[model samples]
Target: MQQLSWLPTHPDLSGAIGQAKRIEDPLQRLHEAVKLAAHQRDFTLTARLDKLAAAGIEQHAAAARLTPLRVALLSSHTVDHLLPAIRVAGLQRRLALSLHVAPYGMYRQALLADDPALNAFAPQLVVLALDAHDAPLQLPLQASQAEVDAAVAERVDELRLLWRRARERYAAQVVQQTLVPVAPPLFGSYEALVPASPRAVIERLNAAIRAAAREDGVLLLDLAWQAAAYGDGLAEPVRWHQAKQLVSPTLAPLYGEHLARIAAATAGLSRKCLVLDLDNTLWGGVIGDDGIDGIQLGQGSPS
Candidate 1:
């Protein structure tokens, strides 16, 4: 397999950014600009780079042969800031992504055959991002377990239909996300045992998503797993509630990186082997002193 072209040995972020910005071709500009942004830790630069990358995708379309990835994003929330970062990260892994970010709140509409824009684009990869909070209805805690189950099932059925429609209308490889439930509800303990609570509904939806992914052979990105990893930092309440930003601006890179990793793996661009430091990683301690038996991390010992 061919190795990806990473950042040049020269560590000149500004110079590289300036050079990439000058390039006329958006995809080519993205190829260089994203790498520069990935190496920088500054949030300001990340935001700028994300915007730059997005502009690249928006200003021009890649020549079919030049782009290795033609990805159309169908998302519930505004992901204009997210798609560019994802494109650049994918480039790092050797996939030249040509990202078409569908308008926000088009997650359902894009899957339908009548949507001329989606039908016209017909991307090779379809990224379907949905949020449970965006659903039209929200049942209260007073609702019974049966009622909650029915509501959850209804949403699940809608999701499955969306996947099926996408499959039927296009040959694109589908990537869908498991919804991340918001923070603790105001009902608190009262909502804890209630199966119809917001949290419970989201959990049920996630389970259904997983099952559907298995049945439909769709690529599943676990946003719930990402949320757990980041703790409360996952969702920015102010931005989420006010602007409908599904993920916080501060943690957007993490989401971008996760998306890129999955896309790279799907595109056969990810690394094949993982070298582990056996002493600490593979085993609990050094084998020379622990003599294997003393070390934990075996079938008998606690992981």
Candidate 2:
């Protein structure tokens, strides 16, 4: 285990990752990797450790009991940060996930063109995490509503072409994320004043994307709703400007959970029950000693 950041905050993370890496048993290694992945806030390190464990699983595939899910990740921005999140989600869902990341900014080429390398790395699922900047609908501050609408229509056609080519050439299901609205819009507060602003254009583009995904049988991941679930921290303007990050680093765990649930559902591996610990969870204190009156379980009390 290599320690790089605050140890007090992530005491067991490094150790767990190391232990998982050294373990010979594939299932045990993956279990430990999942725990380690959930604890670390450093996404880059998380991706490294998760990939290490996945490599081991591949090497020992004959002995591994769970079927491995070969997934290709296609994104417009720096998404090495999301690799571990997806792996952790797969672990939680009892699906072994092996990620193959397409070259940065080459998703269109990988999808539309008959790339031999992409075809050879045949995946079971292809995840496309797109952004407003990746699409053609991003308009200048002075653009009119007519221009924005026209651009949106063209973007939809581009998406359709990409999806059509992917399905025809690859044996994989497309999992695409709808475009997230651009923050700190070029038009500022007035951006929402009319339907022609950058914000409105992105919103309309997202809706069109969702509708197209539904009609085409693509697995849609609602990143917009996921951002809302994580609140304002999910989409900080500074992070976007600095690293082109779609969301805050702290929200990775929740993101992993959502992705895991979606993958589990798609694979028909839904959990029967969600186990939760007691004590601080079910009540304020131990249920044994705390009488019925001592326990705080009412409409007002959170317990």
Candidate 3:
């Protein structure tokens, strides 16, 4: 685990407190002082500062308890815009922030797994950024904004109600973490190994693999469905047609992106060791008969 010194504070509260401290009114000064002390970096303060700050909030500042929080940020695009505000709040409240990039669907699956350590982080809030062009609808910007705002307001209200219900069921011991779904992956990979099919043996093997994956937790992204959608009667014969269809210029980039996503997801999980059948794969000539120099590695000989 990595450690960084910062705390999370409410931006609204922090700003209000800062403004309040500048006012001449005794009541306001006291309010602001309490706010400041509540969000202060260090616990140690002189009796004079504590008394002055505490009296304003109508409560003893020292008696206030602060909980350490962990926040995880999941997003596809750069979240640089929110970093400044998040950082300010973090510094004020002493929080730990972990940021990750992944497709929204994948993150949703991960959250549903329900790990206690994940819940303890307790991401209570989320900041989502979306581009209109990427998710275009028939409506114009003004209309879309109104629609989006209403949708978000409704979601917030629904979440509050859900939280209340969850608290009631679990009591104070239940820890709640927020899962915010963002835009889907712009690029992802789906793969299937179809044997020389219509050949009953090969088709059965393919079906079995698909079935097993479905039974397990793995998502079996059916390439056959994709082929049916994209290929114009071009994917029927798996050995010849599907292979040829894959090399088509229109499908190359899509295929490449899918393969890249799968590779990225499984990266660092295990080592891939390639064992070459050296007789045909590495050198052209038979190693038993040919001396090292006689072997057809780089030379023009068609061994």
Candidate 2 has an lDDT of 0.70
92, model 1: CA deviation in Å?
1.2
Residue 168 displacement (Å), model 3: 12
> Candidate 3: global Cα-lDDT?
0.34
Q: lDDT of each prediction vs. the true structure?
A: 0.69, 0.70, 0.34
Mark the regions of model 1 whose C-alpha exceeds 4 Å error after superposition: 1-43, 47-67, 187-190, 231-233, 274-303
Query: What's model 3's TM-score?
Result: 0.22
**lDDT (Cα, tens digit) per residue for candidate 2, span 1-303:** 222232225666666666567777766775566555444445555565666567556655445454577778788866676667677657645677777888888999888767677888887788887877776555675777788778888988888887777777776788888877765576666767667676778788888888888999888889886655567645577777888777665566556666667677767887687888766576776677887677675464446
Candidate structures ordered by TM-score, highest first: 1, 2, 3
> lDDT per residue, candidate 3, 1-303, as tens digits?
111122234455445555665676655565445444334232122122333443333232223332223233333223333333333222223222233323432333334345354356454332222211122223322344345444444444433453343334323121222221122332233111212111222223334434443443233324433443434322223422333222233333232223222322322222266888787457787777886777777555445
Provide the RMSD of all predictions against the true structure, rounded to 1 decimal.
8.1, 7.0, 26.2
Alpha carbon lDDT at 253, candidate 3: 29
TM-score (all chains, Cα) for each model: 0.74, 0.73, 0.22
